[model samples]
Each structure stands twice: as C-alpha cells, then as structure tokens.
Target: MQDIPELENCRLCEWQCGVNRLEGELGVCRIGRPKVASAVLHPAPPQSYTIFLSGCNFRCLGCQNWSIAHFPDTNETPRGYVEPECLGEEAYDVVNSREGKFLGADRIFFSGGSPTPSLPYVEQVVREARKIGDIKVNYDTNGFLTVDSLKRVIEFTDSITFDIKAYHDDVHRALTGAPVEPVLRNARYLAENAREKLWEFRILLIPKISVGEIKPLVDYISGIDPTLPLNFLAFRPNFVLENYKGASKELMEKAVRMAKEGGLENVDWSGRVGLPGRLSEKTSDKYENKGGEIAGGIAKEAGCVTHPRNCVACELEHECPIKNYRPAKKSI
Candidate 1:
C-alpha cells in the first residue's frame, strides 16, 4: 500500500472519511488494499484487457457484478492483490498480443463496482504500464467521485464510460444508496470540461423503474452537449433486484427514440433484453420522494432499512443488509 499514499487518509471519493486504509481503518468502501477481482480480454466496444477491481463505494440494488462489487461481504473470492508493476507489465503484454489484435484490443480498461475506491492503485498501474510502452487506458465509472478524483481520472484516462443511474436525487439514492448530486456534478464537469476523454454516458433501462428518469436525464445531458454520446443499456436483473423484471427490447427502443426526440444527437442502446421476471409491489410510502418509489420499495423488500437510502449517513452502514444480501436469482 506504500505505492499508493492516498490510502493514508483517503479522500479519493466524495465520502472523504479520512480513514487510514493503509493501517486498517475502513471507510465507506471498506477496501484495505487494492485487489483485482478478475481480468479478461473483453470483446465489448473499445475492446481491451478489462481489469475488474474488487470492492465499491456504492451498494447498488441492480448491480450485475455483485460478486466482485460486494467482495469479502459475499462468498465469492477474488484474485487478491498483485504488485502494480507486475500487473502493469501483464496488461501491456496481453493488449499487444496477437489474440488482442485479432479482437481489436487497443487499451487497458479499468472497471469495477466503481473504480474511484482504487484510484491511487489505478494510477500506479498506469504509470508502470507506460514505462513498458505507451498504452491507452479507459475508465468505467458510476461518477460518484470528487472533483479532485475526477480531475485525476481525466489526467490519465484516454477514454471514460460513465454511468448515470437517475436524474432525481431520491431515485438515485433509492437505486444506489447515494445521492445523484455528485454524480451529476461529475457528469457535467466531464461533458463541459473534459469532453475529449469521455467515451459515452451509459444509462441502464430497468423496465418501469428507470423509464420515468429517461426523459429528464436525456434533457440534462443534451443540455450540456447535444452531441455527447449516450447509450441506454437494457437491464438484466441482478443483486438485490435479481427478481425484478428485465428491460424489454421495446423499452430500449423507446428510450432511444425519447433521447433522439429530446435532442441528443448521438443516442444508442445496447445489452441483452427481455429476461423474465415480475415487477414487485410498489411501496411509495416507504420513501418521502415519489420519483423512485418502486425502486425504494424493492430496496425495502431486500432489507435496506434506511429511508431515502443514504449509505454514507446510515447508522447501519458497516453491517448493511443490502451488502450482505445474497439474491437467489441472477438474470444475467
């Protein structure tokens, strides 16, 4: 952990707990040392060697990579910490391999439950990789990072895939146990200030859950820059929302249409569509906000005790039921 000094009094993200992760004081992320959940030569757009980092700041209800995100809280084990130098060399070698070229690989992609928790470690890895040879790097984020963190991310990353869960604060909190303000702030900062490094903005369409958010979110992004790339991903239920209905193909098409009509010039959609499940009963009264009542209801059913779902402020954050939850169903 000495290689990444930020762990001493980490403020890498908005929580700013100031805990010494190096000496075992845990913050909201609960990650002591950076660890690699897994690494793969992915075939997705901007194909490259994708490194899945362990742990996350957000306890999202619909996380597809819960096994990696929830980490030690869950039964799944990760490929623990590797020296940044070694991992960097491996990333460079693999991305330049013949198999990589055949698959159109051209960069090293940092993805996780959210990469902000491991920002310092990621910088070390990139530094070591560049010593071997210049390598393009892409960062996939939920956009909950602080202004300083966002600036650091923009400094090293060649591209960024940003996720916007909801436009409304209540809905964002209900869905991810965090406020939407910081995410929105970071999104606007990237679009207005560092547009060149941005790859695209990704919004997951979760049947009825995210539909109401689409129009408002679209308007917000188009307001920043109508030409910024945006992609609506069809949701396949996982994590606490494992039993919820997945987004249908028709829903995704509708989202694209809505974005286009809302004035986004570069709108698109992706991901597997129409996996089976039933929408849970809405418990709007559980939350004060009406925007994400259904999502709030689902979180309530899954044992999230906090109203409005502020993880950073919740007294039960360390022993979060949502973090410990093991869903019986996984649509993906």
Candidate 2:
C-alpha cells in the first residue's frame, strides 16, 4: 500500500487540515514528520496487553491526552522518531522480558487518538512484530478509516476494538467533531469480513450528549450481528470539558438496556465499577474512563475473572488493574 498522499496534506483525521505531516508539518493531531510517542510492553487492562502510539486524528472536546492530542504549545515538541524496526525490536524485548521475567501478557494492541490516520507507520510496526512470533495483534480504533485504508491494515490485525460514537451522523459529528458515516461503514465492513477475528463494538454513554443516541447506535450494531459484543462506557468529563459531570449509574443502566432492547445479545458495561473520584484524576478523564471500561469490560466478559488466577505470579502485579478488582461472580 502506498503512503496516503494526504499524509503530506494530512486530512486523514477529523481535523482535515491539509497540512504536510511528512515534511515535519504539524496538523491538528500535533504529530509532525514521523511516528511520535511509542511505548512497548504496557499492561492495558480489560484488553490484556499491547503497545501504545501517540498522535491522534480527532480534536475531541473532552480529550484526555490534550498534551499529545491537542499538542499544547507550551511543552517542548518531541523531535525523535521511532522507526518500524526499532518499534519491532522494542516489542520483541517487551515480549521476551515479560515471558522471561514472568509478566502475564498474551497479546499486542495498537492504540492511539485514531491509529488509522497513521496507517503506513502502524503497518510497518505490525509487520515487524509479526516476524518475531505469532502474537495476537489488535487495533483499538475509532472506526474512522476509509474502506481502502481499513483493507490495507485489516490483514495484519488479529482483532479490533472498534469505537462507535453515535448512531446518527449529526450526533456523532457534534460529539467527536467528525461524521459518523465513515465509522459506521468501517464497523459494518469489519463485522462482515473480520467476524472470525474478535470484533467488539464500544460506545461511551455520555450523560446528556449520548444517551438519546444509544438506541440508534445499538440498533445499527444489532443489524450487523446481535452476537457481537457491545460495550457501553460511562462518560466522565476531562480535558476540554472538565466541568461536565460523569454519567450517573442510572443513566448508564438505561443505555445498557437500550442496547439489549435493540436486540444486541452480548452487551457489557465498560463504565466505572464504583469509583467516582478516579475519573477526575486523569488528564483525559472521559477518554481514560472509556478506554479503561473497554479493556476491563471485555476481559471480564470473555470469562477471565476480574482477578485472574494467573495474575498472582505476574511480575507486573503492581501495575495490573485486572488483578486489583474483586472478582465478579456473575458473568457479564
């Protein structure tokens, strides 16, 4: 696949500002030139394991990593870039270190503000990681990539955790500053083609903003496959909308019910288990809460108890949230 020419005039993301990202041109996503932020061997909860990339495609009003996503003008800009080979090397090291040192990780995840915006860079990273071993590679994405872009990277990915913001185009646009059409299209395409691969749909049930839109979003997902796992995240205000309140438990339950009523067979809550204050502590509380819920909820729904028995012997125990939770005796 050829590098998107738009990468040079990068409107790949929601910002759609035709900025030259390859020539060190910074667009709304803030990543200039090459692959920016990268971390290997991180323990992402509920989702198991993965690598994280920086930069984003959307200018979410309540973005958590505003520093990275919005590219704060005050901080020193990152100048270094990690090549795909270097990324692969780092991933290999992480896998080896985890296995040799008894770190309990079984998967690799590619996450970002919107990873599809940097398909070429991510493809390079995934291709290299695949060379090391047969690790399950997953993409945690916003479901905004064009079909052509999705086709290019879909083969390299083993699973996808796709975020569906809202069912209606207007609501989706209002919430994320991007249209819902592309997201919906990609979701349907992935469901049909990537069904054998674990394809989970996530929705953030924002208090006032997203509640009414739940039925439509759930209806759309149900039409694809009622058995597809639909995750509902409780919204917390942070980043740009610090004053916005977190979704009430009652509201979250209502959204979950909406999904079930829409004929969705597999549904789970990716919202806060019980902590209200934890949302305020994070930079992008809403985004963090959404991500945490997706990771945690999906893991629990998969039959791995909140506190997996294997977690006790893991070296990264201190950092593992999955082990910290009291086991839910009932299945989600």
- Give per-model TM-scores: 0.97, 0.73
Off by over 4 Å in 2: 1-6, 9-19, 25-30, 45-49, 72-79, 99-103, 273-332
Candidate 1 structure quality by residue, lDDT tens digits, 1-332? 34567889999888888999888888888888888999999999889999999999999989989888987688878888988899999999999999998999999999987778999889999999999999999999999899999999999999999999998888898999888999999999999999999999999888777878999999999999999999999899798888888889999999999999999999999988888888888665755545489889888887888888889888888888888998896547
User: What would the per-residue lDDT of candidate 2 be over residues 235-288, giving only the tens digit for each residue?
Assistant: 765544444566788877877788788898898786563324223222221222
Model 2 error, position 50 (Å): 3.6
Candidate 2 residue 112 Cα shift, in angstroms, is 1.8
RMSD in angstroms, candidate 1? 1.2
Q: After superposition, how far is residue 125 of candidate 1 from its true place, in Å?
A: 0.5
Q: Quantify all predictions' global Cα lDDT against the true fold.
A: 0.89, 0.59
